[model samples]
Target: MNDHLVILIRSFSAFFILMIIGRILGKQTLSNMNFHEFVTAVILGAMAANFAFNEKIEVIHLLIALSVFTITSYVLAKLFLKFRSFKMWTEGTPTVLIEGGLILEDNLKKNNMTLDSLNQQLREKDIFNVEEVEYALLEINGKLSAQKKKELQAVTLKDLQLNAGNAPQFPIELVIDGQLLHGNLDSNHISESWMNSQLKARGKKLEDVFYAVKGSNGQLYVDDYKDNIQHPIDME
Candidate 1:
């Protein structure tokens, strides 16, 4: 066999094998891309790359490496979930960067955060001034969550002292994709007759809707014909 051919074969084999292994590792490893997970992925890629174009690489060796990586990740995740300290050690805990309108500069520095970065994060939360912030924490996933001081918080309708009473029922769809969700409508004493009436009012029929669901408050939300349009129910 030509040397080039051998190398190409190895590269293709390694690429496919690694891709499958990575898929099996699951989305948690990629989406959040935590520090440890990131490092593990890099290490796995390095291992695969080293053998990608190597003529001497064997499928068995690839399988063994992939197996070890998968098992180790599975074990670590299980252990982390089972124990509090282990979870903290592996994923770390959220750090309080601000409390009571005061900046915890020491905590920020400990987390390798800069004043500028802190300001940027705070700004993202719409807290331009540090004084408006009551508490801010650096979550383990590297996201910042902030709470505004009671007085600084945005006032809702309730806060304005509105005495608006009970919220009305919103219609819920009990069918989608030609499948009837009997459970959603059965308990409400709603049937095909009620559904037809509801659909006729909106110039639609049950079959015309792509998807529909009844929300907790008995409201119906619907997406008809999948034009990416959403219709909210107003039950007066």
Candidate 2:
């Protein structure tokens, strides 16, 4: 009958029931879940909490409530899988935020998202200026899909009118966390002697290195110590 005991019981029961339901519903239910799914989760949690720890509330009552929710979720998931229209109706389509560097104010207003929020999302993608984006979509899962302007995009060697004989090589790390990775060395067709020589150049021993990676270009990148450490030697 203790309030604290009831709260704890409800918390554990909610998690246990929701986890079971989620597993049966599939991973996509959590990953690409829509607004409806999110609401269902909250409702399930509230219902579970009402009975979980209350001494007057029996386990049978909690089981019945949990079962009903799980069954409803399962039915909806099945219906979504069976009907494309149902899926579309439940999970809204992506909304265009910007097209051709022009903000779609109508679509933004329809989604109840402001221009400031769009700009903030753009900044998160390393796009400080709105003019630099060619396309941006607000995904149903709340992810921003953005495309950089043509001039801002990376240019390949061919774009520069340059011809190369061979593809640039990348290095493979033979050791990490003081453990030797012979498989990586073999994949890169590099030998132990070559790795030792590369380490010697930096005056760093394999044991001293925190991590090391070899590039396809046969270049060795060694980090003997942690980064972001302000040491006098690092400043120099």
Candidate 3:
């Protein structure tokens, strides 16, 4: 066999095999690319590259290595979900970097993070001063999550002494895509008669609504199927 032809065949084979293994491992691993996933991705990429170019290595051996690693990754994910101790062992717990506006020097040392790095991360989150942070945690994914002190937090309607009524029926989907959810309506103690009355008041029927929800403000919000817009600007 020609060397070029052998290389072409092996490249395609490695490509397709990687794709198959990726699908089996699931989208969460690929999309999030967590700790375990990061290691697996690097190893798989190296193995695939060697499989494509390293003619000295047998194809069967490469396939077996890929399969073993893929299986290990898939099983570990499942085990992590069901077993807390196993998960903690593989992926260490979140470390508290700051508490009550005080940076924990010891915790920072444990994470091998310096004051400059911690400050940099906080600055990335728009916190220029560490004193503004009520709590900060170093997540397993190497991301820093911080909570602002009460005084530093954004003021809402409640803080302004304005009456912003709560939405109990919030997220209640009364009608979705011209289809009314009978179960949601019944569960919420709402009736079809009330829904019909609201539609009638708007001079619209059930079919006219693309989406409708009982908002958090205890108000009926409805969207038309046909927006009847001559010029609509799409953000995308």
Candidate 4:
């Protein structure tokens, strides 16, 4: 066999093995992975890369390394779920960075975060001033959670003492990529004849629609396949 062919085979083999392991580990591993989980992913990726391109390394050795790391991560996740104390120790607790319109400098320093960095994170959440925040917490995953002061919060209809007749229902996706979603239509109490009539009124056929949804206001929103604009301009 050619050397290039052998390399290609090994690369593909490593890719498929990683995919299979990822599937077994489940979605949580990819979403919001904690410290141990992040380390495990990095190690597995390194081992897979070595297995893919390194001709001198044994494939079985790489496989064993990957398996051990994944299993340890899985066991730790399960333990964390079953025991609160273990979870708190492993994942750490949410640190209060701000309370009652005051910044907790001690807590911020403990998390190795500077005042400038904290202010930047606050700005990202649309809060330019720390005085506007009533509460702010640094989550275990390194994300900032913040709550604005009562006076600074957005006003709602209830605050104005006004009764808005009915709450809007969630829009139902009736069609996607020219395919009719019969089940969605049935559940939303929309008839096929009504859908056909709406399409006809707009001079459109079912196949012409790229996406369609029935809004809470009883209006049909649609995007067609045809590009109506002669010249496209980038808004961004």
Best candidate, TM-score: 4
Clash pairs detected, candidate 3: 167-216
TM-score of 3: 0.62
Candidate 4 — number of clashing residue pairs?
0
* Tens-digit lDDT string for candidate 4 (1-236): 89899899999999999998888787888877778888888888888898888999897888788889878988888887656568879789888898777899999889999999999999999899889988888988888998887667787876466434544344678887687888888977889999999999999999999889987455799999897999889653
**Least well predicted 10-residue stretch by lDDT in candidate 4:** 162-171
Candidate scoring better on lDDT of 1 and 3 = 3
Question: CA lDDT, every prediction?
Answer: 0.74, 0.75, 0.85, 0.84
Write model 1 residue lDDT over 22-104, tens digit each, in one string: 67777677667665676678877887887876546676887788778777876776776556467767778788898767899
Clashing pairs in 1: 170-218, 170-219, 170-220, 171-219, 171-220, 172-214, 172-219, 172-220, 173-213, 173-214
How much is 104 displaced in model 2, in angstroms?
Answer: 0.8
CA shift at 145, candidate 1, in angstroms?
2.6
Q: After superposition, how far is residue 96 of candidate 1 from its true place, in Å?
A: 1.0
Segments of candidate 4 deviating more than 4 angstroms: 158-236
List where candidate 3 sits over 4 angstroms from the true fold: 158-236
Query: Highest lDDT, which number?
Result: 3
Better of 1 and 2 by lDDT: 2
**Winner by lDDT between candidate 4 and candidate 3:** 3
Worst 10-residue lDDT window, candidate 1: 162-171
**TM-score for all predictions?**
0.57, 0.59, 0.62, 0.64
- Clashing residue pairs in candidate 2 are 6-53, 169-216, 169-217, 170-215, 170-216, 170-217, 171-214, 171-215, 171-216, 172-214
